[model samples]
Target: MVCLRCVMVVKEELNKLGYHYISVVLGEAEVIEDISAGQHEQLRTALLKSGLELMDDKKSILIQKIKNVIIELVHHSEDPLTVNFSEYLSQQLHYDYTYLANLFSEVQGTTIEKFLIAHKIERVKELLVYNELNLTEIAYRMHYSSVAHLSAQFKKVTGLTPSHFKQLKDKRRSMLDEM
Candidate 1:
């Protein structure tokens, strides 16, 4: 689960199966009761029906948690981090940065940094489409060091400078849900 609606679907499915959950966060839930195999299967089926899957493997769960954390920070959170993303992720996940970086690259076929840049650029695209924030403000909100850096990255990823991209007036920004 990566969004509030996803959490709601999971919670509703658990309730439907007569299971009690203490809390449901991005990629995890705290259950208040043990569920039978049949109930577990039912819950899994219900989640699958809603386009979610039950993560049973430890590594997969950890990876999901990592992705959720990144997604939340990049696309959802408004408060900027005081530290760099790598350090923040290391502390949040309680793993060495190198280990997490290697695992992410090995499993996702791209570095975590690249994933972050892609998401950030996507967010910039959304902001540009909204036309609510100027380029400098968008760069600051997205934690870029400067507008030039943001423009360079936006151009690198999308093959168009931010100003040029914004001028098109016909470009559609892809949502995180579709990514």
Candidate 2:
């Protein structure tokens, strides 16, 4: 689960399955009662039908958590993180940064830094599409050191300059889940 709609779908599925959920947050849902195998399977299938997966393994769960953290920070948060990303991630997930990085790379076939860059570029695209913030504001909001840095990274990732992307007739932005 990476968005509010995904959380809604998960909650709806749990409710349909007659489970009392304690909470349903991004990438995780907690039910009050212990689920039997049959119940779990039913819930899993329901989630699949809604285009969501129920991760049972610890590693997969951890990966999802990492993704949720990134998605929440990039797409949802208004304030920038005061600490460096490595320290923040390690503090948030209760694991060493190296372990999290290795596990993420091993399972996802991509480094955490690359994943973060992809998402940041995607966010930049979104802001450009919205036309709400100027390039400098976007750079600051995204925690980039300067507009030149943001523009360079954006050009590298999208193969188009920010102004070019904005001026095009068909502006394209990727879905959050797709990223």
Candidate 3:
């Protein structure tokens, strides 16, 4: 689950199954009652049918947690991080950065840096479509060193300059899950 609507869907499905959830956050949930084996299978099947999966493997769960952290940072947080992203991730997930990076690359077939860049670029696209902030402000919000750097990355990823992209008739942005 990467967005509020996804959370809502998960909650709806859980309620339909008559489970009382204590909380449902991105990529995780806790129900008041212990889940039986059959209930667990039912929940897994229901989530899968709704385009969500109940991940059980440790590696897969860790990968999803990493993705969730990045998504929350890029899409939900307003303030930039005080520390480096690597350090923040290490502290948040309670694992060494190297281990996390290697596991992410091994499971997702992409480095964590590239994955973060992709999500950041998607957020940039969203801001451009909204037309609420200029490039410099976006750079600041996104923790880029400068506007030029942001523009170069935006062009490299999208094949168009920021200004050109903004002028596009159909501004395309990827869904968070797709990213």
Which candidate tops TM-score? 2
lDDT of 3 by residue, 1-179 (tens): 88888899999999999999999999988899889999999999999999998988899989989999999999998898899999999999999999999999998999999999999999999998888999999999998989999999999999999999987734344444356
Query: Which of the two candidates, 1 or 3, achieves a greater lDDT against the reference?
Result: 3
Ordered by lDDT, highest first, the candidates read 3, 2, 1
Candidate 1 TM-score, true structure as reference:
0.91
Q: Evaluate model 3: give its TM-score.
A: 0.90
Per-model TM-score, in order, reads: 0.91, 0.91, 0.90
Tens-place lDDT per residue, model 1, 8-79, is 998888888777899999999889988778877887888999999998887788788788888888788878
Q: Ten consecutive residues with minimal summed lDDT in candidate 2?
A: 169-178
Model 2 alpha-carbon drift over 4 Å, by segment: 169-179
Higher-ranked by TM-score: 1 or 2: 2
Q: Which candidate, 1 or 2, has the higher lDDT?
A: 2
Off by over 4 Å in 3: 169-179
Q: Tell me model 1's lDDT, rounded to 2 decimals.
A: 0.87
Judge candidate 1 at residue 24 and give its lDDT.
95
lDDT of each: 0.87, 0.90, 0.92
